[model samples]
Structure formats: C-alpha cells, structure tokens
Target: MADNADRAGEIIENRLEGMLGAIALPPRTFAEPICVDCDGEIPAARRQAAPWCVTCAPCQSIRERGSRR
Candidate 1:
C-alpha cells in the first residue's frame, strides 16, 4: 500500500540519518595553511572561502574521483 511504502521510506531515511550522525566526521582543518595532499601553500582567499579544503583543486578532484569507487 502507498501508506505502508511511505512509512517504510521514512523509517529507512531516519535510520540512515542516525547512522550518519553516529559516524565520526573529519575535523575541520581549513584554517591550516598547508594542503594535506600536495603540500602546496593554500592561498588565503581560498582558505577563507572553503575552510575545510585539505587539497589543492586538482588534487581534490582526483581524490574525489577515487572515492566514488
């Protein structure tokens, strides 16, 4: 039934939210001056805009692609 399906969906969504909340999130290190990936010096403007960037743009893109697997 549609009502049953809706309820099931809500339950699944809540469970997923709880699981995500339980996982430890990486600490915010955007205020750090160095890139964790390539050791490139992060520009002040970029750091201000994205306070949690750990890699330069190119390195970050590569890391993202790898994580998709």
Candidate 2:
C-alpha cells in the first residue's frame, strides 16, 4: 500500500512539473504605485502583493464594486 502511494505521488509530481514547464509565464514588472483617484501613497504591502496596482486597496475595492454593474 505504501509503495503504491509513493508511486502515485511521484506520478502527480511529474505531471505537475510538465504542466508548469508547458506554460510561458510573463515577466514581472514593477511600477511606481500611487492612488490615482485619491492621490494617496500606496502601501508597500499592497504594491508588493499587486505589482501592477495603480491605486490603494480601498480605492481599488471601490472601483471593483462600481464595475460590477
């Protein structure tokens, strides 16, 4: 039973590696983050979490909510 589980794990790992290799991930780009709407300083945490962010978290949330219409 243990041997079977080990083999299954190996198969899954190999498949995952192949899948990852098949995709071409985009290169990350960093921008100077500033809240366009509020002209407030965007936190480093938010910028690191979303490198392409143009606004602070609160502004972004509001923008997303407004777009749901």
Candidate 3:
C-alpha cells in the first residue's frame, strides 16, 4: 500500500513533469558543424553566434518561410 509520503512525492513528480513539458529547451546533444538539410558546412561565425543552430542561413530562411504558410 502507498503511504502519504509516497502519494505526495508522486503528486510533486507529476507536477514537475508537467511544468518541464511546457518549457521549450534546446537540444541536449551537440550541434553538428554541417547543415542537416542542404549538406553544406555551417559557417564558423554562425556556429559561434548560435551554438544551438542546426541549419545554415539559407536553409533556415526557407524553413521559416515555409512555416509561415
């Protein structure tokens, strides 16, 4: 049988999980130097500017434009 402490812990854990799910976090893995879509090398300047970036400027621009539709 579950005790009161266990029930409280489960409630807290559930709430925490819900809160974490609502947050938008960056990927935990390292970003590759190459763009995933165009197979072009991501610029060193861009990489330095945005370490979490996964696409080059052109590919990213296209993706953004497509997303607006």
Candidate 4:
C-alpha cells in the first residue's frame, strides 16, 4: 500500500512538471508600432497589452486560429 501511494505521488509530480513545462512562456521581443499585414494603426492600448504583437487585432486572431489547426 505504501509503495502504491509513493508511485501515485511520483506520477502526479511528473504530470505537474509536464504541464508546467508545456505552459511556460517564451521570451518576447518588441514589435513595431504599425501593423505588418494591413498597414493599419496599432493602438497604444493593444501595444501596451501585448508588446510583442506585430499584427493588428484582426490579423492576430486569424493567425492564432490558423496556428491551432
């Protein structure tokens, strides 16, 4: 019974480590003030929210959806 409990705890710890590694954030770099796709204005609010955003909101959404597939 004690061995089984230790094994379960180890499995849970491994799973937690895997999840944390998967969700770890990548290093971000600065983006330009203009939208690269449509040449639209990138709002200051958006720039503040996502400093690494290169495209505008619409383009970013499309790109994200595409990447999901």
Candidate 5:
C-alpha cells in the first residue's frame, strides 16, 4: 500500500539521519593559495572544492599515487 511504503521510507530516512549524526565530521579548514609541494598556484576552483588542500591537483594526485605503494 502507498501508506505502508511511505512509512517504511520515513523509517529508513530517520535511521540514516541518526547514523550520520553520530559520525564525526572533519573540521572546516582553509589552505594557502600556493601548492606546498610544487610551489604552483592553487586554482580557485580546487580551493573551493577542497578548502583544506595544501597542494594543487597534479601534486596531490602524484602524492596519493606514491603513497599507495
């Protein structure tokens, strides 16, 4: 029934919200305009996307790949 389905959806939504609330979220942060690793300009879009980034996209990708080994 439509009512039963709606009630089920509500229950699921409530449980998800509770779980999310219990989880810790990272603190908001800002980063320097220049990339620490490459000494390049950190793009405005990149800073907006990840305000905590210390490196530009290329440097960040390289670092992540190197760390995977």
Candidate 6:
C-alpha cells in the first residue's frame, strides 16, 4: 500500500508538471525589439533577458487577464 501510494504520487506530480509546462509561455526571443500592442520600445536588456515579452509589465497583466477568458 505504501509503495502504491508513492507510485500514485509520482504519477500525479509528473502530470502536474506537464500541465504547468503547457501553460507556461516560452521565453522571448532577441529578434524583436518592440511591443506588438503599444509599440512601446523594449529595452535591450529586457529583450535579451525576456525575449518572449510582448508587452510591458502593466500591459502584460491586462493581456493575461483577457487571455484567461
């Protein structure tokens, strides 16, 4: 019974990890330099660090909320 529980827990953990991975957006690429929405200039450092960023922090929050629906 203990072994069975451990196996079950492992399976659950793996599935949860997979689901979280699916929801996670890939990091930004360095190719793009501007925000698609507001046309705001993305800083060079930010582009390098978070290349997948489409909007600034404030706009991103708004976009995320809309996406949830």
Best by lDDT: 3
**What overall lDDT, based on C-alpha atoms, would model 6 receive against the true structure?**
0.79
| C-alpha lDDT of candidate 2 relative to the true structure | 0.84
Residue by residue across 1-69, what tens digits does model 2's lDDT show?
579889999999999999999997644665466788899989988777777788988998999999998
In order of appearance, the predictions have TM-scores of: 0.50, 0.57, 0.56, 0.52, 0.61, 0.46
Model 1 regions more than 4 Å off: 1-30
Relative to the true structure, candidate 6 reaches a TM of 0.46
List of clashing residue pairs for candidate 6? 28-51, 28-52, 29-51
Q: If the candidates were sorted by their TM-score against the true structure, best first, what order would they fall in?
A: 5, 2, 3, 4, 1, 6
Sorting all predicted structures by lDDT, with the top scorer first, yields 3, 5, 4, 2, 1, 6
Model 2 TM-score on a 0 to 1 scale: 0.57
Whole-model Cα lDDT per candidate? 0.81, 0.84, 0.90, 0.85, 0.89, 0.79
Which regions in candidate 3 have their CA more than 4 angstroms from the true location?
1-30
Give lDDT tens digits, candidate 1, residues 1-69: 579889999999999999999998656555677888889887888777787776777788999999999
Of the candidates numbered 2 and 4, which has the greater lDDT value? 4
Q: Write the per-residue lDDT of candidate 3 for residues 2-40, one digit (tens) a residue.
A: 999999999999999999999997755556889999999
Clashing residue pairs, backbone N/CA/C < 3 A, model 1: 30-51
Write the residue-wise lDDT of candidate 4 on 1-69 in tens digits.
Answer: 579889999999999999998995634645678999899988888887787788999988989999999
TM-score of 1: 0.50
- For candidate 1, the lDDT comes to 0.81
How many steric overlaps are in each model, in order? 1, 0, 0, 0, 0, 3
The total of clashing pairs for model 2 equals: 0
- Cα deviation of 15 in candidate 6 (Å)? 16
